[model samples]
Target: MAVGLVAVGAVVGLEAADRAFPPPLAEAGMVSAEVQDRDGRLLRAFATPDGLWRLRTQARDVDPRFVSMLLAYEDQRFYHHSGVDPRALLRAAFQALTHGRILSGGSTLSMQVARLIEPREARSLGAKLRQVLRALQIERRLSKAEILDLYLTHAPYGGNLEGVRSASLAYFGKEPRRLSLGEAALLVALPQLPERRRPDRNAKLAEAARQRVLDRAAVAAVIGAGEAERAALAPVPATRQALPTLAAHLAEAARRRAPAVMVQRTTVQAPVQARLEALAASAAAKAGPRVSVAIVMADSQSGEILAEVGSAGYLDSARSGWIDMTRVPRSPGSTLKPFIYGLAFEEGLVSQETIIEDRPADFFGYRPRNFDMRYQGDVTIRQALQLSLNVPAIRLLDAVGPSRLMVRFRRAGVRPALPAGEVPGLAIGLGGLGISLRDLVQLYAALANGGRPVQLGDGVEGEPGLVDGAPLIDPVAAWHVADILSGVLPPSGSRRSGIAYKTGTSYGYRDAWSVGYDGRMVIGVWVGRADNGAVPGITGYATAAPILFEAFAKSGVGLTPMPRAPAGAVRLAQAALPPSLRRFSAGPAGLVSARAEDAPLQIVYPPEGAKVELGTDAAGATLPLMLKLQGGRAPYRWLANGKPLTTLSRRRVNPWLPDGAGFSKLTVIDARGRAASVSVFLQE
Candidate 1:
């Protein structure tokens, strides 16, 4: 009975000790972040705390050949032994006894994992005993593969670099999944005295260590003798190469999203991203310094951001490169014209071939002009949209109402920023409001997706995607817009392709934008100063559109035909059209009775309380002082300082030659004898 009691007491004592001195490796230290592409390729890696690049690696991620060599050199009987090697221990003990000094310390891969998790500075018997105990405990709990994973994750390769993955990338600028013979041997040798034999620091010692590993590998039959000899002669790297910086902005964002997660997978395709980034970098470099570029490519069907280059260079300090341009709100120039025309189609106000007057017209005193300050007179709805005529787009926006367009954008998960205290206006069609590139992409994606634009994001089947059920415009309208855009000419030198795309330039050329989509993908491009500084001679057509075309060629994504015209869509000649559908009229006359009191004509430019400096012509010669009106009838009369300027005939946009610099009252009287006036200081 006493012997039984003693045995039970011993069992209880062991359980208590196990609980008291459990392994200190309950959690790993700050593991370096790993951002992977959709196909499971590394996009980027960030260092851990203490400035170490210790990315957690699994045994599966390592090359089989490297694993074989690692086993042969580091621990011959790793799988057979429990934690410590009895043969090695006895050999070390006998050598120490015979030589009266220690030749080698017996440490198995499992024991090394234990030491790595619970590092001991002192190289003494007590520390060795603790490592053995922890290794035995780990072996009892984890499988052989798990133990190897732990070792591979924690084993030191060189300064601030732990794990084979980190070391492989630092030295070879590639993944450890495919390593050459010399590379495999070098990786196997570095863990022991990592700093002393670091290739970047001491190439000779590193080579010698690698040769030793190769010899051992040959003897163990992990590699043939000839292969080992060839590996021994292979050169060691002299310096560590930088890890990949592709899709840097997105990688950083993913890391921030789950900072504690060792590996973060994103919905990015590495090859496509690499190509787009290269194109953007080349374009930005030729454009100028302090100019950053952003590109966003998404699947129209899925709304997944397949490739996103937030900036041309994430480390470019001169361009404020850290900022994400895709999220920044900027004026989207004529790019929104397609949607405006689509809205008009949806409203049954016009069809593709409907005759629309592109002449200068005033809207309650706000006059719109074509982009080049030249008028094309009357053109078909398709012609105006294809030409990106500002007056026609504004005329359409006026008819549809900017408020309705804003509401549609909201339904598609887009929110355009309006100027403080200002409501949506016809000017918005001319890039007066602010919209992020991503929001613009989402809206366009909706049009490409048959009027239902899902929210733009990075998601897949396992994770819920952001999808909006509401249509941005009717399916027929979206289809008409796509057909027209597809017919627009591709950028110069680019082959004809079936991509429905549009270009835009903000007022003052502060922003240039290009958005295009095939049947499958939507890509948005933005080129501008992050600080909103204007870039000279840069327009969407000249800059952003070409990039869009080149991006498609490099993207390697297959071309998808634009959606066919919906059932209700129609193209008609002016003579065959309904009278109401013949031309778009959005003035006071169109909305109000002719007998109603005529709203007083007003001047939108040369504000009564502001100063204006009319810029000179392209040749630095006399600059025409532009005169614009909003709410006046055709054949309007104007006076400058009570002096007759001219008797304007027909729908007119006239410019007055400023008489030097001084304050002047600019007045205009329409055919109805109703007048509006503004006083301003003009600089010549």
Candidate 2:
């Protein structure tokens, strides 16, 4: 009875000690963060706080053969023992006594994990005793699988690489999920003396160690004798490979967003990203020094980014590669012309074969010229857009109103950056506004997906999904745009890729952009100096368009047919077109043959400096005010407070809605570009 009491007291004392001084299990959670592709392939990995490449590894994350080999070599009775194997320890002790040396140190996987958790420099008896006790506490707190996971995560394999996953990536350039027989045996033998047997530095030691594990496995019948012999003949890696760094910008962004997340999964495809990055680098190199390139490829239907290359080289300081050019706002040149034509088509004001003047023209005070300083005189709406003519686009923008275009862009989930205190204007159609490559890609996605805008997500911020809002343009208009763009000839030395595309060059050659899309994918490319410096001879068609074509060719995705035409989208010949649709006129009047004899434009009603009372609705809201005008020509554009009204009017009587009771400056421009203004005090 006395002895039983003594035993109970000892058990109570052990329990109290275990409760007071728990193992440092939190240390096991300090692992490196990883960014993976859609298929869970590692894109990049960041070191831990202490600069160690210690990736978290579970039993399932490793090859089963590796786990079996590790158990057979490290601890034969690992599962049978609670923490320390008594029979193995006794045999080890007996062997040391008989051999007069330490032939083996019988430490179970759990005890090794405990030592790794709280490392000690000396191999003293006290250290061993502490490890045994800690192992017992660990086994009591964790299951067998958990214990194995801890061992796999904490085991060392060479300089700065701690864990089987890290070792496998560093030495074999792949994950530990599917390792070869030789690779698995090498990893199983590495933790015993990681530095001494590092394959990159001590190749002979690593080979010898791997051979020993294979021999032991063969003797224990864990693997066949012939298999062990074959494995033994496998060569050890003599060099270490760097972990993947594809999508560097995106990976960094993801890491910053969720710093606490151990694994960040993105919608990017590894193969596509890798190919595009190489293409960007090659393109930039061919372009010249101090040149950088950015590319973004996404699915038009789902809006998921398949690949995004932010720069030519992530570490090229000469090209300012650290900057993410995909997100930078730069002049968009003539890329926005398609949208202006789209709006015109939606309003039924123009058709593909409609004749439009492309000569130098003035809108109020803004005069736009063609890109090559040469005019095409008169060209079809399709030819104007295909040629990227400037004056025709400005005329279309003036007719449709820039404010309406801005609203359409807003509906597409993008807002172009305007100069401070300035509103959207005619120059915007000519790349006067600032937009990013990503934003441009998003805008073109609407055209590819039947006028439905898609909001793109970077797997880190949000998700790619269809947005519920006003259509960017009607389905018929969108189809018209696709038809015209698809007919644009490819650049020299490039075969046609049955996709619709457009190109733009920012003013002064500061930015080059090309955006293209098919039914399935949309890719946008930008090439220029990141510092916004001008490249003398660089133009979108020459610099950016070629890269775009090559990117699509090398992207490994087959070209998908463009969407078929929607209802009422038939392309009529010039003769068959309606009288109004046959030729685009600045005014409702078909043409003004003599402008000198025309009456001067004037607002007859609401005479200058007059106060007018506005009628209010039942909800106490001010109603639109009617203003009459006797104009120089038909088709007058009205603007109040520097904002253009939604549509052009040919009836001379136009309505203006006041936001509230205030003085508003109302201006009207006639077809001959004649303008008149009136300031009226409006009161409800």
CA RMSD of each candidate after superposition: 12.0, 6.7
Each model's lDDT: 0.81, 0.87
Residue 32's lDDT in candidate 1: 79
Top of the candidates by lDDT: 2
| Per-residue lDDT of model 1, residues 8-102, tens digit only | 99989977887787776666555777888888788888877678888888889889999999988878899999998989888888998999998
TM per model? 0.82, 0.88
lDDT of 1 at 175: 83
- Residue by residue across 1-684, what tens digits does model 2's lDDT show? 999999999999989999999999998889999999999888899999999998889999999989988998999899899999998789888998999988888899999999999998898789989999999999999999999999998999878899999899899998999998999999998899999999888989999999989888888888999999999888999898887899999999998888999999999999999999999999999998999999999998898999999999999999999999999999999999999999888766689999988776656678888889999988999999999998889887776667667767878888888888666777899998889999999999998999999988769756898989667888999999999999999998789988899999988888889999988799999999999999888889999999999999999988998867888989999999866567775532122323311657776556798666665433445556656564367677889899998687665545567788889998989888989999989765
Backbone clashes in each candidate structure, one number apiece? 3, 1
Off by over 4 Å in 1: 1-15, 27-29, 96-103, 255-257, 459-468, 570-684
Query: For model 1, what is the C-alpha lDDT against the true structure?
Result: 0.81
